[model samples]
Target chain A: MESKVNKYSKQFILFNSIFIFCWLVISIFPFLWTFWGSFKVKADFFSRADWWYTVSGVNTLIETGGRSTLEAYINSWIEGEFWRAARNTAIVTFSVVTISLFLGTLGAYALSRSTYKYAFWILIAALVFRAMPHITLVSGYLFPFFQLKIWGILPTTIIVLVAINQPFTLWLLYSFFKTVPKELDESALIDGASYFQAFRHIIMPVMWPGVITAGLFSLMLAYNDFTVTALLLNQQNYTMVPKINAFLGTVEHGGNYMWAVASVVSATAPLFMIVMFFQRQLISGLTTGAVKG
Target chain B: MPHKTFFWFFFPSGLAMILFIGLPIFSSFFQSLHIETEQILIEVETCDPFGCEMEVQVDQEATGLLREESPLGRFNGFGTYLDRNHLAFDDLGAGWETKTSIRNFISIVLNLPFYKSLLFTLTFCFSVTPVVVCLGFVVALSVNALAKSIKGPVIFGTILPMIVTPLIGSLVLFWMIDAQGILGATLQKILDDPNLSLKASRNLTWITLIIYGIWHNTPFAFVVFYAALQTVPQEPVEAAIIDGASRFQRVRYIVLPHVYPVATFIALICLMDNFRVFEPIIGFSAEGVAQSLSWMIYKDLRNETLMLFGSAGATSMLTILGVAILLTPVLIRTWKEFRTDR
Candidate 1:
């Protein structure tokens, strides 16, 4: 029996090792390719592929093309307008997060404790609204403003984004708030603390993680979004994704491969920074709040 | 003490939602019912290399109508349902005409593109969700099963892929599949079949996408399942284990039932996200074969006669119903669990 158990244990270890290797290779290699490609010079990229590391002076010939891999990195930085796109993304993310956080917390508090007959309906309706594709809503959403001749498309977009993001934010915050002991509210009430006071003093601190999680998700969603921005923003007014997409198109059309790599790198910088900074919280929050909600 | 405070708390969200979400939806529904003059038809008098490829541009202004026809071309009271009277055009704008017939909705539902998308979404959701859940479950259960020393790194390693932006994930996949890429070269040799190019083949694209999506999304499921598993009542699991039930059997009877709610929740959100998926399709559509519902809506809006209005609205309604139907069983099961727990 002991020998059989040992054999099973060994087989399990071997199976797991193979699975882990495949999983790691599959998940990590793509990002690595992107990272490496970002450093390749445009001129040598194609040639290097055709005559890769022949080592009969091939490496030197590839290196002498007056183009460095780092050129794409620099070119993408300048040409892709990374700074402006980053600024636009930051503004959108900050505004959406702040507004939704405030509204979601309040709305969630109400839905959590208030025995209103319509609360469930409100939640379900919000979910349905959020579930509808943004592309479906873009024309109708922008039409009213178009008729009124309101040209501030960016601000209008932010408002729409906040509205769409609220459903998930509110749902997540409500769930978190519900997890807090209700006696906290009861005690605060006994002490003459109003609902607002109870929320601010008692529940807020407990639910801070949930609020942050929702905020991060909102930020990520806004930052990573491509379709709506592509449809709404003009060519001259490129967001991060549209800019990356343009470079991608250029590469597909056999334009500068170097520029494409650079664009991808610059576009992903904020994402990388956010992930590195908030890796743990982001993962946990993603599952609990975003997925589970 | 009074109801006013509750109103204040609830009213803003409700009102804002009504104005922003509800209002647009209803107005779009209304707009679908009107005759649109914005439809532009262009007639090209050309002597082509093959023959004269004459293109006729229909001007909506000629009809003096706000829309080409009432939505669905028929009149239903207040446009609450599909109308058949509004479709007056035989073929308004060359091969792309104002389809003001029941065929529009029927085609939207039954056509190859819609079915392709539906199949893609179903296979996608099913393929990805289980892999994610299983991967997540393994990571979560193993971590919980492991000694404290081995848990941390495994958890972090498993979660590393989930933090990157989803769009970035696709871009990264694109680069990896380039001809000279490390795996690309290896795959070129191993998957020598010409059909295996992840960039070109729709089936390959779907598989690659599901794999990438599962890799990115599993960590999320893992974390929730992990956290929920931690909260699962230990006594029942221990009792089952003590009954000489194997680990798999114990998990089947004890751990699975406990984790079912979280799994259902993840599955629900995943279904919605997958159904509305546009980015991966857009990213992967270099060959233009991957036309999803969201992409179709985008395409329809660009048509000159605005042929998309009825179909898009109908599609959205159908999609909502699909979601409701898909989630009903899970919803019922969840409600039962919650009630029993209470």
Candidate 2:
């Protein structure tokens, strides 16, 4: 038992611990520092006098009459109109996730259950589609969209995002559906239920875990998207990622660097919470396809 | 499933893909074959103080009418693809004819915008993927040996870099490495060069972006590899240990084979993702130093006054071609596997 427990040498263990400690610092320090500095004024955050000024918030106190303030948050959310972008993001993500999962489950269920050669071909075609860089597809959309007068609307962006997300969502859900026994659905079919009926009544309840996982990924894709949103949508319909990008352009003249920082922290907060609560699901989703392969 | 059932099940997804993803490739190809119409010019006679003068002016109304009439513009057939900003066939021929040596020819090729971006994209993709795989494996192995109590928090910290928005993650690191920020100041103090800036040098910018790529992507590989490591069969490891195998030997023999498939999967994903690297360039303001294929298309479409739709379309088509080439190996492998399965 002792030999089993102490398999590695003491020196090896020491080195491993040190390496992990360094890695943790490298991984976590940037976010911690940025989160801490988001509350400070620009002068303190990017202090020329001393790095310690950031930690102590000396310049923040001098500028805002306190150790820290919500000046940047208020400035970004209200003055910069980041809330509109946040709302746009909310709408886009909700629609994309719901639509993607709806279409994906049906398609993936068919692909998984079928042994036909065309189903394999469809999956392969999806693989190719998934590999295409999204910006390339956006370039193709611009001319037609401008002609159709649908270039800058939320629905256009949602539909395009759902399309772009389908290949991945389908692939993921197909793998998950493959894991579920075919007999469960076939049994329902033998009882005279139609395919759609079996899918709705028999399969969906057991499919939530997979649906939620795929939904999470689809949500991330829509939320973190910049290329599709930036290129397809007009300024009024900008999402948070592109809106944060717009903030960078105004930073030089408006001195709104802290506002951008505050917005970034705000944008990351939800993702942080999602990670905290759904770490297991996230990990499982990432490895699902790989494990099967 | 019957054909009818399958069609009904797959209709919505197929329609979406066909309309958006499938048709766009053809649309981009068609758009790439043409350039926008030149501004319409008309001669106008004006009476000056001395004499009547003839002047040529752009007729915006006529140009607008023409654009409205035929938004596809006049066909230029493969002209846009071979232009200086794209494949640059003429420029390559010129460089080949005038070069003094191989090195000089390589420099000339890199001088072209398209090839320069291609080089950077390929360099970024190849360099970042392997480092990420290796580092991720090491981290996975190390974390797997840690006491279980701290594993959860450690994993939470590890994945933060990956799960955060790429642009935001890069911006976070960008601030910390700004000239006056903590890391930047520490480096300047250590080197005793107050004027030192990571953003100023081209090579340094490349290295910084590559480092950012590795940091952002390593966590994904780590999580996958760690999960794979968890499922590694214990019997083989126990037998090897009973046979007095060294720790290094046991790992080399037992663990590596188990994780090889996961590593390949990681590499494939890394290559695909890294090829489309764009947001970091904007976040780091490194556009002056490095650009990727996606960034090139973005620049073309984002032109302030007149969007260069044809130029962007040409680049988009070529980028799609590059993606096809990158995917060929995996596609071929899948094809072969499919055949064997049949």
Model 2, residue B58: what's the lDDT? 92
Best by TM-score: 2
In candidate 2 chain B, what residue range of length 10 has the lowest lDDT sum?
Answer: B329-338
Alpha-carbon runs more than 4 Å astray in model 2 = A1-7, B42-56, B339-342
Note the DockQ of each predicted structure: 0.36, 0.72
Candidate lDDT values, in order: 0.63, 0.91
Estimate, for each residue in A1-293, the C-alpha lDDT of model 2 and write its tens digit: 44373367888889999999999999999988989999998998987668899999998888889998889999899999999999999999999999999999999999999988999999899999999999999989999999899999999999999999999899999999998999999999999999999999989999999988899899889999988998999999999999988898885653488888999999989988987888878889988966654
**Ten-residue segment with the worst summed lDDT in candidate 1 chain B?**
B86-95
Error of 1 at B304 (Å): 8.8
Clashes of each: 20, 0
Interface quality of candidate 1 as DockQ: 0.36
